[model samples]
Target: MASTPIIATLLKGMAMGAADVVPGVSGGTIAFITGIYERLLAALKSFTPAALLVLKREGWRPFWAYVDATFLCALFGGILLSIATLAHGIEFALAEYPLQVWGFFSGLILASTIYIGRQLHWRALVVLVAFCVGALAAIWLGSVKPVNIPINTLTIFAAGAIAICAMILPGISGSFLLLIMGVYPVIIAAVTEFNLKLLLTFMGGCVVGLLLFSHLLHWFLQRYRQPTLAFLCGVLAGSLSIVWPWKHAVVTVVDRHGETVPLVQRNLMPWDYESITGVSSAWPGVLTLFVVAVVMVFALEYGARRLQLKRAANAA
Candidate 1:
C-alpha cells in the first residue's frame, strides 16, 4: 500500500489540532473526515507487548516500520505545531466572534453527521437504536454542569487520562472534558508557560489513556462497523448543543487568571438573542458562514475522492 504523503498527513494533523483547540470540536472528527481514522487507530493500537517483543527480537527499524512511526511523527508533529501557534488565535476568535465561529463549527459538525449517517445501513433496527442511544448520551454529557475539582496531582493525572480518551473520539471534546473537570485553565496555562513537570505528567496520562482507549475503539470498529459508525454519527448530531450559534452564558466561573469565563450557556434563537441581549443578532453573517462551512466539508470529500482516483489511475 502506498503511504500517504507526508505533507498531506501533516496538513490533516494541523486541521485536527486546530479543531482540538476549541472546546466543542474533536480532532478525531477531523481524522475521520480526512480518511486517516482507521490508520491512526491501528498505529496507536500497535503499541503492545507484541510490538515490544518484535523490537527486542528484530530491532528498532522493524518495530518502527511495524508501528508506522514516521506517519505518527509527521501527524503528531503537525498537531503540536498547530496547537502551539494557533491556540491564542482560536481563543481570540472564540471570544471576539463567538457567533460566527460557532456557526461555522455547527455547520461542519452537522454536515459531518450527515456524511457519516449516509454510510450506515439505516434500515437496521440495531443501527437506529445505537444512533439514538449515542445521541442521547452526547446530549446528556453536554448538558451536565461543570464541576469544581480541586487541582492536585491525582486530579491533573486523571483529567489527562479522561480528556485524552475523549480527544480521540469523534464528536467528543477533550478540552470540554477538562472544562467539566475544572482543569481546562490549568492545562492551557501549563502549555503556555511550558511547565515541564505538569506537561510531562499530563502527557504521561494521555499516552496511557490513548493506548487503552484506542484498543477498545479499534476492536469495536473492526467487529461492528455499521453500528459503531451510526453511534458516532449520532454523537456528531448531538454535539450541535455545544456549537449552536446563539447562546447566552447562564453560569460563569472565575479562572485562576481572575477572568470570568462562561461555564454554562443556553442556546437561543437569533430573534430571541436580539431581544434578550439588546445587540444585533447578526444572523445573516452567521448563517452565511455556516453555509460556507457546510459546503467546505462536501468540497473536501469531493477532492479526497478525486485524489484517490487519480492515485489509483497512476498506480495502474
Candidate 2:
C-alpha cells in the first residue's frame, strides 16, 4: 500500500503541534481531540527490539518498516512547525489581549473538565470523595509557590520529564506546570527570541524526561488503570485553579527607581491561603464559551468516530 497513512499521521501531528503550542492545553489532548490518541499511545509504546535494530543498523531508512514512519514524521514535523509558526502569534495575542483570551481558555477547560468528569465510572461515595479530593487538592496546590530549586542539568532533565507528562495527559497542560514552577514565561520568551543555548538546554531536559516518563506512564496504565483514571480525573479537576477568570491585584509596590509603578495584579488562587477573601468564578460570557467548547469537543469526537467507521467499512 502507498504510505497514505504516513501522510495522515503528519497531518494529525500538525494538529497536535498546534495544541502543544498553546498554554493550558496539550498535544496529547489534541491527539484525543483529533481521534488518534490510541494510535499515538501505541506508537509511543512501539520501541521494539526490531525497531531498535533497524534504527541501529539501517537508520532512518528502515524505521518505516517497523512503525508508521510517515505518521511519526508528520506528527513531529507538524509539532515543530506549530512551535515555529504559532508560538509568537499566541504570545502576542496573550500580551495584547489577556483577559479575553484567558476567558475563552477558561471556558474551554471548564467544559473539558465536565466532559472528562462525566466519563468517570466513580460511584456515589467515590464521586463525592473524588470531587472533594480533586477540588481540594487543586485549591491547595494553586496556593503553593514554586520552591526555588537550583538550576542544574539533572534538575532540568527531571523538570522536562515531569513537564512532558502533563502535556501527554489530557486536561493537564505542560505550560501550566512550568508556570507553577516559575519557568513558563522564561522558556517561552527564550523560544520566542530564539535563544539557542537556553532552548537546547531545555530540549535536552525534555528529551530525557520523555523517554523515561512515557514508559513509566505506560506501566501505570497497564497495572493500575482504575486508580490511574481516578487520579487523572483529579488532575483534570485540580487544573481549574490555574485558569480562574478574575481576581484582585493591588497597585502597591514601586519599581527600584521609585518611578511610582501604579497598577499591578495578584491572584486569589495564591492569596486564598493567606486569609484573603475574594470571589472568583466564571461569568456569563465565560460560561457560554465553556458550553461552546463542550460542543466543539463533542462535534470533533463525533466526526472522528464517523471517519473511523467509514474507514473500517471500506476496509471490509
Candidate 3:
C-alpha cells in the first residue's frame, strides 16, 4: 500500500511530462486524472513563513519538517527524468501517425474539458468573461505559427520559466506556449539531439520558472481560487482549436542549418466527416484505445484518492 502511492505518483508525473512534450495536450490533465490535483496545488503552496524563518535562522530539520519536502522531490524527479527518456518516443510516434496520436489526445482533452467545465461554479460576470478570455486566448495560441528566435542562456531560462507554468495549468500546453514564444523547436531539437549548450540554457530557464511560478501559483490558489479556476476552465474549453485532428502546411522552408520545416494552418480534423475515408478512420482499434485511456484516467483518479485517504489515516 505504501509502495502503491509512490508508484502511482511517479507514473502520473511521467504521463504528465509526456503530455507536456506533446503539442496540444496538458500535463495538468494527467495530474488531475492521477488524483493529485489538490495535493499538487497544496505541495506548491507549501512555502510558509515558518519555513522561510527556519531556513534563515538555522537548521535543515526544521525546514524539512515545515515543508512536505519528500513528495515534491520525488514528484519533480519523476517529471524531469520522464521528460528526458520518454519524450523521444512520443515525438517519434507523433511523426508517424500524427493523426491517430493527436486523436487520442483530442479525446483526452475532450473528457478533461467536460470534467473541468462542470467544476466551474461561477456567479460573477467578470469572472465569467475572464474564462472566455482565457479559452479564446488558447484557441488563438493553437492557430499561431511557431516562430524562430535567437537562442541564448538567459532567454532560454526565461522560456523555461514561462513554459513550465503553462505545463501545470490545465488548458495551456507548455510546448505550444514555447512555440508561440519562438523556442519550441529549438528546445525540442536540443533535447532530442543532445545539444548540451541548448539543453542547459533551456533547463536553467525551466528551473527558474518552476521555482518562481510555483510560489506565484501557490499565492493564486490561496487568494484568487475561484477566478483562477474559472480561467483554467475557459482554457480547457478554448484549446480544442489546436487539438483538432487535421492541419495543412501553409509553406515549407529550410531553417538556419538547412533543415526543412513545415509551416501549418489549422484544418478540420477528418476534413469532411461526411466523407470519412476508410484510410483515416480504419482503425476500429482506436475506439478500444480511447476507452482504455479514459478508464485509465478514471482509475488513476480513484486510486490516488484512496491512497491519499490511507496516507492521512496513517499520519493521524
TM-score for each predicted model, relative to the true structure: 0.96, 0.76, 0.84
- What local distance difference test score does each model get? 0.88, 0.64, 0.73
Which pairs clash inside model 3? 157-205, 161-209
Report the Cα lDDT for candidate 2. 0.64
Ranking by lDDT: 1, 3, 2
| Candidate 2 C-alpha lDDT tens digits along 135-238 | 67655655555443555556655666677777777667777567556566566777779977777777787766665666677776677655555665676666
How far in Å is the alpha carbon of 70 misplaced in model 2? 2.6
Model 2 steric clash total:
3
Worst-scoring 10-residue span by lDDT in model 3: 273-282
Cα shift from native, residue 275, model 2 (Å): 19
lDDT score, candidate 3, position 276? 45
Q: CA lDDT of 40 in candidate 1?
A: 95
Tell me how far the alpha carbon of residue 27 in candidate 1 is from the true structure, in angstroms, after superposition: 0.5
Off by over 4 Å in 3: 1-4, 45-52, 56-58, 122-127, 271-288, 305-316
lDDT of 3 at 287: 54
Best by TM-score: 1
Error of model 1, residue 96, in angstroms: 0.9
Decide which is better by lDDT, 2 or 3: 3
For candidate 2, list the clashing residue pairs, or say none.
10-74, 13-75, 161-209
